[model samples]
Target: MVVFNAPFDITLINAELRRHDLGSLEERLGAETAPVIDPLVLDHSLDRYRRGKRTLSAMTSVYGVTLQEDAHTAQVDVSMMLGVLQEMAVRYPRIAGVDDGALHQFQVEEHRKWADNFGSWLASKGRVDDISRAWPQE
Candidate 1:
């Protein structure tokens, strides 16, 4: 499955399902979870040089992808994310060439580095002493 931010979306979905006493997608599918392709992570990995915001709207604009409607709603966001990813793949073929396992592993490590760096920065400011070193899920 594809998502703009897998961790956030999955967590929110899981929480809602629990609140409503409904089985999660994982439970219904009889699997832990499907392998997720997060466009946000992929965009960060592909174009580390781009400055300014990295929000879905910003990315869609940068990638020359047009959404059917405004962003924020799940459908629009996912559609735009997929479009951005498609554009990224065309621009950086190597990214799309990576196998799923390798890509997942790379994102895991990249996310860890980002978290660790943020944690250290927060520690310097006395904002946080430590941060959870989890990625994709907690």
Candidate 2:
């Protein structure tokens, strides 16, 4: 599934599914875990040179997504996300053709790289705390 923030949304969904005795999402996917396309990770990887925030709104603006109204609702947010993905695919065509497993693995590596860079930057700023590089949690 494609999501803006895979970790947060997947965690909440898995927790609720587990609470209802529906089994974990991974089990339902017939794999170790569900395949996910994380736009946040993709954006960071593709536009590492770009500046400013990476919020959904910020991304929509960067990708030239036109919002008819506020994007507080899930429907609006999802639509905007799809639009952003479309723009990304146009700019980075290989992303659109990657197989599910390969795409999932790519996101995993990208997330790790982003985390490591962020940790190092934090260290450069005098914060010497360890950063958890785990993706989508355990």
lDDT for each residue of candidate 1 in 10-107, tens digit (9 for 90 to 100): 77887888789987868867886646777777776677667988888888888889955668887787778889989988888887898877777777
Candidate 2 wrongly placed segments (more than 4 Å): 18-23, 27-30, 128-130
TM-score of each: 0.84, 0.84
How many steric overlaps are in each model, in order?
Answer: 0, 0
lDDT string for model 2 (50-124, tens) is 999998888998988986487868989999999998999998998989888898898888988988999999999
The TM-score that candidate 2 achieves is 0.84
Clashes, model 1: 0
Location of the lowest summed lDDT over 10 successive residues in candidate 1: 129-138
The segments of candidate 1 whose C-alpha lies over 4 angstroms from its true place after superposition are 67-69, 129-131
Worst lDDT run of 10 residues, candidate 2, spans 129-138
> Model 1 TM-score?
0.84
Candidate lDDT (C-alpha), each: 0.76, 0.85
The RMSD (Cα, Å) of candidate 2 is 2.2
